[model samples]
Target: MSQRSEAGSDAKPGNRLTVVIAQLDFLVGDIPGNARDILEAARSAERVHGADVVVFPELCLTGYPPEDLLLRPSLDLRIQEALDQLMAAELDAAIVIGLPLREKGLLYNGAAVIDKGRITARYFKQFPPNYQVFDEKRYFAEGTEPCVVDIRGVPVGLTVCEDIWSDGPIESAVAAGAKLILNLNASPYDIGKQARRKALLERKAQANGISIVYANLVGGQDELIFDGGSLVVDQYGQVAMEAPQFSEGLYAVDFTHERHCQPVSQPLPEEPSLPHNIYSALVLGVRDYVNKNGFKSVVLGLSGGIDSALTLAIAVDALGADRVRAVMMPFRYTADMSREDASTQAKTMGVQYEVYSIEPMYDAFMQTLAEPFAGTEPDTTEENLQARIRGVILMALSNKFGAMVLTTGNKSEMAVGYSTLYGDMAGGFDALKDVPKTLVFELARYRNEISPVIPDRVISRPPSAELAPGQEDKDSLPDYAVLDQILNLYVERDYSAEAIIAEGYERADVERVTRLVDVNEYKRRQAPLGIRITERGFGKDRRYPITNGWKIGK
Candidate 1:
């Protein structure tokens, strides 16, 4: 979803000119619609915020990480059309907007400073991120020139997203006589990313002794979610103002030659709690993926577990109760409380829900498999039949309706192959695929803070698959708190078993968990894509060879 609206009071702190930060979300590849949003926000910044200059996020016109869309033949033409529209608008304030510039058979990620129906200055992004989910080098040439545009007689430096992450661009702009720097960003969300950005920007502000105004894009694009934690840091390394996370708006910072930047006592946004940040990221990710892809609604199995409960709440909050469907498929060992809790939560959220017992289906599958297992002891193969039965029921509902099926497995189960393949994992998307099991419970509590949707008993009860009599998660796996930490160290940080053990974890548990993760690569590869809230998610950030024979220790 793009920005809803961003009209806030314009600050006029006497000494400096007011520069508005257009903290808005832009839809990827929607050139025409994105152009309209840019124009509307530019005009509003000047008219409502009384901004002398309004700064938008990186690639505001074309959207960030446009990926292969940059390879399209008509991209250059669309960009030129957008620039022409901006020039034609004759915006009152000097508007800074990011776009891709194609010239002389070379394309550069650029930010244009427009004033008086003309392009006053242009700054190409000095650094193009090429790691992790970024592949900017594929479409853009490296920019070495420094850009400092004169806004109301003050020289303001311009830098794109990755440019500020590095040293050269900001330093180059400072050398080019910029008293203030306006950095535009489309940085994707990860746990602790906002803190890192804030600290880095503050240090840059103090080192350069230039007031920095940052504008960031907010919303979701496919698997990534960009949180709008835009900042305004004074020359003294003090935070003057900061926009709230998961919100879009036009925020302003006043600046002048006399004071460098006009000072204010604006209260800094409180640090977002872990639940708040991750939950917000997931909601935005689901909302955009669903709406942007033009899906009518979504459906999922409601197992009365913490993972599905959180997923259901997130889906309802994102698309509303009308667009979500909950299905409960119970087999022989399925508990009555599971059904009761699923019904209670579904009714509380006012979602369309149904219960279809999978007893007949399970029986049919068992009868077919009885011959194959005639001489073998019963194992996980039989237990997996139950989950596969439920998966079929949920998918059938999704097919009957047009709703997409949402798989409800968390990162912990995904890491060690604790989930059944094509059974519980059969779906269009996984809401908690990046989230650890420990965090899932936290999110359930977080959602309840807004309103009491999840039953208290659900939260307090010990988690179980209910696939067999007296089944519990801890019976087959280590405690979640212990497992999640080990998973994070190994999967996210690439820590070796020895290193994890040195950190006080038992050698046996570390070796066992890491072994499971390495062996289960094939399963995770088949799982549906989900929201990425951590630094390293399984799909994009972490890649492993499934056929490897590497072991933790001799």
Candidate 2:
């Protein structure tokens, strides 16, 4: 493939600058499909939106975190073939698509600038983020030089996700005489991250004295949920256009680039509130995980608990109630209110549901264990048996119906090993695996606001597993508020137990939570893949070995 430039001197300044931000969900390692999606998006931008330029998310061709697949020599050739196909398309608009590039014996996380059947320019990402869910340093060699290419009289500066998060890339772009900055991103979703992104973009635009168009990828890839909160900010630090978070769409914004002296008058679209934002993240995460992985429907055990209720609500909202099935697995110690809440929530969500009582199975297991445990007093062993039974039934239904089982355990439970492996953890996907228990309540309230689908009693009552008689979550663990705080420090912030204690945490509470987290590494290893709404999630971010001897205080 020959590279050519369409550089022209002193092109006329056009008043209407149309930029299309393609908020797409690209599958990992699906090069052909991803290329097709990009071409289709480009066609849509040119034919439908009349856009002069279209921008895609970072690494849209090979997906983000191709992991060790970058080691394969053939992957780069495949991406090049895809890029060639895209460049050969008949679309008139300039296309900026992310793909890996091999230049001078080093691989680069790069984006190609294609216009009118030719590759004009390429921008390599400078900051290859290595911390917290990113391992770019492991694959691609970082680029030091900034790229600012001229596209149809508009000087466009190109940068990837992490580049704009810092100062150097954006500053270099402005220094290189770029009028507009196009930032491609695959930023994963976390609580309050959307707001932080907007704030940073606003600052970047104001500081650089250029309009910035931020495009982020949307979907769940294993654990990572990339919330597509793409937006355009003017030089005066004002938002011109904002795209919806956690949904896929082609959004266009017209920027008047003729010597901007006054503030841009484009109406700023309203962004979703915090609770709604979190809810949408969960919904998109569940929806993408189910649909992308070829699952027709989802099956989850409805325990009349808050975690399951929230997970069910998210699943139904994402895949619709018709595709979501809830099963009530009642046991010996299960309360009537628990059953009633589960049934009511399922009915309110309009999902298909069935009652599967586990009393008989519980009795059989107990009878079998009676001979071996006759002398010992029954503790959590009996309680865990009921949970395991419920897990078995859910998995059985999943196998029978070809549906994916959605585990409802929250991050707090998963973090502290409060959940049972081969029981509640026996599912293909976990909907709320990254969401802490405190945020779970906030999401429940948010769900009720849209339509009071989840029963108020489910949200109001204290969360309980009901594995044993009169059991509550607090009986085994600390309050969710305190627990989440400690977890945020330990997991997200990477604070030590002594550091957490120094930051006003009770020594005993910190010790207990840290110990649980350390001892439960084996269980987390067996947990299902879920949407990553946090900086540190179980599958990728937290990778502690099960047989480690490193104690917290030691």
Candidate 3:
């Protein structure tokens, strides 16, 4: 489990305290299964490492962000049963775990310290975050107190996820004579989130003059990815021990108390590159989504474009090449290089590859719509027919063989409604929904650095939908370098058109891009959900009225 030497039974409890961090993943709403894992981890922490206390992530019993499941009437009963099961094990070490606690008819996000077949202390979360993918205020009432307990002659304080982010709870615990504080969390991963957490912990521990232990959950929960970079910080705000990110395991730390307290030395993990962090998050997201949802395999339309090529690479990396299938749906508009690149990449990745020409399907659809389109001239309707044909063919394959269809649309296209609904957007999941066009190029290069699966030409070619002859994306959209900057200002930061234009952008470009983002709300509403990497993705992080008439001005 942990990499620490065993502190045998002869170790004195008065001078030494062994606290193990259980940085593991748990399924949401699987209370029984989660409890079993918690119990097993607790026992191993005590028996193998001789731990005095073992800390688990927030909501480890019922999982984090249970959403509407917390409103169920049986939620209280299930939580109680899980806690009772943990206590019945009668472990020698104190187990600090999190759950939704109900008291006097009000539910609170709380944690309990169970030791010697009883709950020694209970702590409720003081601050419940309500912004950006967190809706705890709707489900949990705020707790206004601090809880401190004694374990192995050390006065340890307890705090939930949001409580540690603020100063009041830790101050109260310190005032109550606590030497060490343990925080349980289910914090999700975003770009630069780990750095922010380390900074926050260092500042808080130094400010309070107390050592802190942070235990975080690891795995994918729908659109959220928990990276599990749990760690221990000394009273002087120095990182004492650090756990690996995007991994699941038990890590141990020892604390010796004299006049003050500090964690024993442990090797710190090397920081991963930015591309590595993002790629790992995507891989974990796809792997858990596929396995947990019971999908046998995944299939996608493999155009030689950068977006689809990246999606194919992620699918193959997430699930093995055998569990991934790539289909090249060619039409009259499809280029020879597109076909060649798709075939070359699929062959390099060693996945199941097939060719399905949409020419017959397009012809059949046109023949059926001839009478209804009597007065219509050829336009995007004709172009969209090719895309719809490819969508239908991919769906048919998914229906016949039971492989989940993965869509390939990046955020730059999604923000401007450059994508066609029920066409390229017709799939179950999208791994790059929050990624921008520029980031897609960077990730492709990063993957190739690991192994040269994607052909060099694919990365160097101009991006195009190829629904019509020479249909490059630049025809309808602004330069991605400009569009992504405006999007970050408008969609993520909520900047007005006038304000964005004032930021050195042209007025016409600002107006047009923001208008597309507004008018396309209905389309994005119908698109499949995907992984969230930015501060604000088009998922729960950003919610706008699809039918509103709000003007885009400062």
RMSD of each: 4.5, 2.6, 3.7
**In model 2, which regions exceed 4 Å deviation?**
1-14, 260-265
lDDT of each: 0.86, 0.86, 0.89
Q: Clashing residue pairs in candidate 2, if any?
A: none
Question: What residue pairs clash in candidate 3, if any at all?
Answer: none
Q: What digit string (tens of lDDT, one per residue) describes model 2 on residues 456-477?
A: 8999998888887788888888
Models 1 onward score TM values of 0.94, 0.94, 0.96
Counting clashing residue pairs in each candidate, in order, gives: 2, 0, 0
Clashing pairs in 1: 16-255, 16-256
Off by over 4 Å in 3: 1-14
Question: Higher-lDDT candidate among 1 and 3?
Answer: 3
Residue-wise lDDT of candidate 3 within 391-469, one digit each (tens)?
8988998999999999999999899998888899998999999999999999999999999989999999888998878
The TM-score measured for candidate 1 stands at 0.94
* lDDT sort, best first: 3, 1, 2
